[model samples]
Target: MKPVNKNDRLLVHVEDLTHDGAGVAKVEGYPLFIHGALPGEDVHIHVLKTLKSYGFAKLLEIENASPFRVEAPCPVFDTCGGCQIQHLSYEGQMTFKRKLVRDAITRIGKLPDVPVHPVKGMENPWRYRNKSQIPFGMEDGRVVAGFYQPRSHQIADTDICIIQTPEADSIMAGIKHKLTEMGIEPYEEETHRGQLRHVVVRKARATGEIMVVLVTKKKKFPQAAEALKLIQELVPETVSIVQNVNPEKTNVIFGDETITLWGKDVIEDQIGDVRFEISARSFYQINPEQTEVLYGQALEYANLTGNETVIDAYCGIGTISLFLAQRAKFVMGVEIVPPAIEDAKRNAELNGLSNTLFEAGPAEQVIPRWYKEGKKADVLVVDPPRKGCDEQLLQTILKQRPERVVYVSCNPATLARDLRILEDGGYRTQEVQPVDMFPQSTHCEAVAWLQLAE
Candidate 1:
């Protein structure tokens, strides 16, 4: 019989944290997940819902708070779904992330002996994000813009987001106010009857260049000129103002056509010594400073001596390929997105790099063909999506037999699973380094180095 019921108020002790940053407390071995609660704390809670084996609870009161708990800085921390662990101290966040990685590697991968190092955290974690994609909606006949409410499409209206750069906040405020003043209706998802859909702002930290992308339901934005002028006046760092038309009635933020309403089509940004031309759709890392650190760790794992070949699989815009090309004999990068490959080629040319080649195809298919055509890689680096590397790619890595492998991951459970596959395929994981790319949030990026066994 279940020990908890709906509307049951009970005192429980939080024992651990879930991957989504929810506190886990067991009532007679039946786990209950509570938000706004941390591990090692006693809290009074009301059961909201119950399932076959688990339940969800609302934190009524923290009878005994953990030392790591701190006041969340953001006003909408509870309602906004952007950040999950804002109430936890930064120090506690780092420790939790490290344990998050360690536990995944140990439990999921079943590799208990693997060395999981401490997370490399930022000194000032606030306002570190360079890109912001905020959705706009109407509430009470006023245009509202901010992050979506938790698990819903409702926009939590706010002018400031502490994680995004100040320029993004300013640009969003200006655009929102201008849209209201210009009688532009915010796009309604249910009816699909409005004009503006979303506003994606990218601010280059290295160079104070900013790109403002106005996503609308159609291309006939008659007030594009005024919107551009307002953004330019609001922030002097504005370099590009573009309009992306998404006529579909779907949840996707962008659509097929992009028109440069004003300014340049692409803005310039730098990471390490490599400069990149970021467009409205480029997949540049949101956190540039930590990106350098993550890429640097991958570069170090490669241990290039300018006499070996490297293959960067799932390469987006040649970020890691360009980083490795500076030291390797040659580097070949492949991605499934053709436009990303074009951007990669453009970025390579922009950086005056000639030894790197990027192709538009799946890493699994392209790499095996490369191996068959006498183009084998000495080092293979993969930075895959949250689902981790494809099984075909893992098989390709084993067949190619690279001397070293550097796996950069944004999801730990998938990383652990992939690492186990590589370990069984004759590669020994040297170490895994966790990098806190998104602080005050549960997300963490890790880079693992592996060597082929003799």
Candidate 2:
């Protein structure tokens, strides 16, 4: 690692935002990443960490006004570090995000070809978040739940994040207060001897019933019984309350040992008159409104007809499969997690959607199973994790050679890399649409439609 030499407060204008919540600025003919600044704003920044080509900076003073700059909704919008786009006008934020997708395609994809679609926005930006994961910790012998500030490991106490339902914010104060009264110390990762790690809350947009899951490292808190008992009484709409004890130090969720203390473990959400079930660990878009638009775009671009058979790989709980099932002749979903597969089946049965079938196994095993059984799908939708499609999976996809491949991805680099595999396997890249799932953060989702080349 080379030492940073230039650390000067330069009058630099923030031109854009990097995918991971850093503001882009050109200082002295070099790119600088200034934290806590917005695009279209000119600000004097204090250069902090630097490299040969690029550096990071701290915002010092505003030199000029950006027409799109807006006062952040949350008081801790800048400090609590939850959202980075709160300072940017919602429309301007969408524009910045569109550029992010375009830039990502240019850098990751070999060819800059597809037109990045216009970003979709919501009628109400505030309270658009359907879910909120609040990090819980013991701060000075008290329980606090919120998000961490940008780049800092310490979790900042977030009172009100603009993304989620107001109920989520209202429940935070009560959660901390009750946990302290119960003598439950929030989990401390460094010490590894606290009761709570985080509070995962979800709200049904239609019912307003919220589900709260308390994440901890241990099973039994001294106040576990009483705390939940009180929570049910205080927050009546809190339909399902559960506890997840995650002992491992890794950031992965502790969903393996989930015990529902009250109500069902899942909630119901409807996307354009079609209802779907969301389990605690199931992958559902956080922003429901954006999800409707995203799914609609995906459905539209898929161009699926009633005659087509679709395969939805990595279909967690069959969100996409069931969504597309009604339009397709039949839909098959493959998932690695058996429990999720079971949930998918149950979801399908719950909604009386029998046209969709779910299989539990690695894509390598399941895809081959379908292949050996001489089953062929006309369209295949692959929505893998940020790591994207594994080589084995990609090989299986090639072998199967579904006529159409719809890849819904969270990471652009991985998506591009996977696209290259398909390209090499005689598939041509088709239209790609970028959706802003996470507003204030650098993370965004892209729906890339892939078609087999003749």
Candidate 3:
């Protein structure tokens, strides 16, 4: 017999939180997932949909609230898809993130002995994001700009977003209004008509330089001179105004052609002592402060002796490679993106770090090629994406057998799986440190330290 049915209202206690910030409650051993509900809470839910194994419920009332629950600061926090877990306190968020990493490493990696440290959190987590990607659309014949609604393409129009930088908030509001006043049409995905599609704003935390990228449906921007002037007047700090053209009716944000409508083609920013020039499409970290901390942690885990060679796999823009190059004798970086390799080389030159070498190719392919050329790394570092390390890269690491490995990961599940593979291949997992990179959201980043077993 099923414990829940459509339209059935029941009182339940939330025992845990899912990775996506949903509350988990069990009814006769059947699981129910309810959004906006926190752990250690009693709630009334109306069953919406039921599957064979689990069910979905809508939160109707909070009979008893958890102590960790707090009033969300963003007005559109309930409906906007930008952030989850905003209702939970900052401390609670960190604790939940730490638990997330701990559980994955323990259950998935099968490494119960490895210690997972508490999440390294920021002093003030609000408004830390240096970049904002806002999609523009039309609603009721009016220009709308903001994040999309949960699980839908409908935009949640807002004048302010608390998580984004102050400069971006002002830019989004000003640009949307300027577009509306100028009678420029917002992109309509249904009809695939109109001009403006998205607005991307990036602000350098250290330098305060800003870049505004306008993604349009076509190359011909209406009133280009007037629009650029308005944008400059609106955002006085903007150093770059770029236009990216995308004619296809696709969901992708960027197109092949990019034009600099005004100012420089790139903006400069600094992470640690290393300076970098970021283009409109460069892959720079959104949270610069935490990135410094994360990279510093990886550098510490490397335990460089000024004589060892280090290899940075999946190094984008030479962030980790340059950081390690400052201490190690030589650092080599491998990236699949060719432009990222170019940017990395330029960044290395900008910092006058002559010992770093960056090559564009798959890390799995490039590092092995380097080994054949009589080059080997004493310490290997990998900062892979949410998908974690590639299987071929892991096999290469096993074959090369670096003395120490520093794994910087965005997804703990994949991190755990990869770490298990390394552990089985004669590497001993030492410890894992979770970093709260994205606050007020369920996402977490971690750095794991491993050593070849003696």
lDDT of 2 by residue, 1-454 (tens): 3333456767888887787667788855678888777777899888888777788888889888778878876777767766777777878877877777777777777648866787766666677888888888767655667887767657787666767777787777777777766777777877877777888888877666678888888776567788677777657888888888788885565647888887887888787756777767776777777877777877886798799988888988787888898798999999998988988898889888889889999877788789788778888888899999978989988988888889888888788888877888888887778887777666778898888988
Give the worst 10-residue stretch by lDDT in candidate 2: 1-10
Error of 1 at 388 (Å): 0.5
Task: Report the number of clashing residue pairs per model.
Answer: 0, 2, 0
TM-score of each candidate?
A: 0.99, 0.92, 0.99
Error of 3 at 452 (Å): 0.4
lDDT of 1 by residue, 302-370 (tens): 999999999999999999999999999999999999999999999999999999989999999999999
Question: Predictions ranked by lDDT, top down?
Answer: 1, 3, 2
Alpha carbon lDDT of each predicted model: 0.94, 0.79, 0.93
> Which model is ahead, 1 or 2, in terms of lDDT?
1
Residue-by-residue lDDT tens digits, candidate 3, 38-58: 999999999999999999999
Give me candidate 1's TM-score against the actual structure: 0.99
Q: Spell out the clash pairs found in candidate 2.
A: 19-442, 129-163
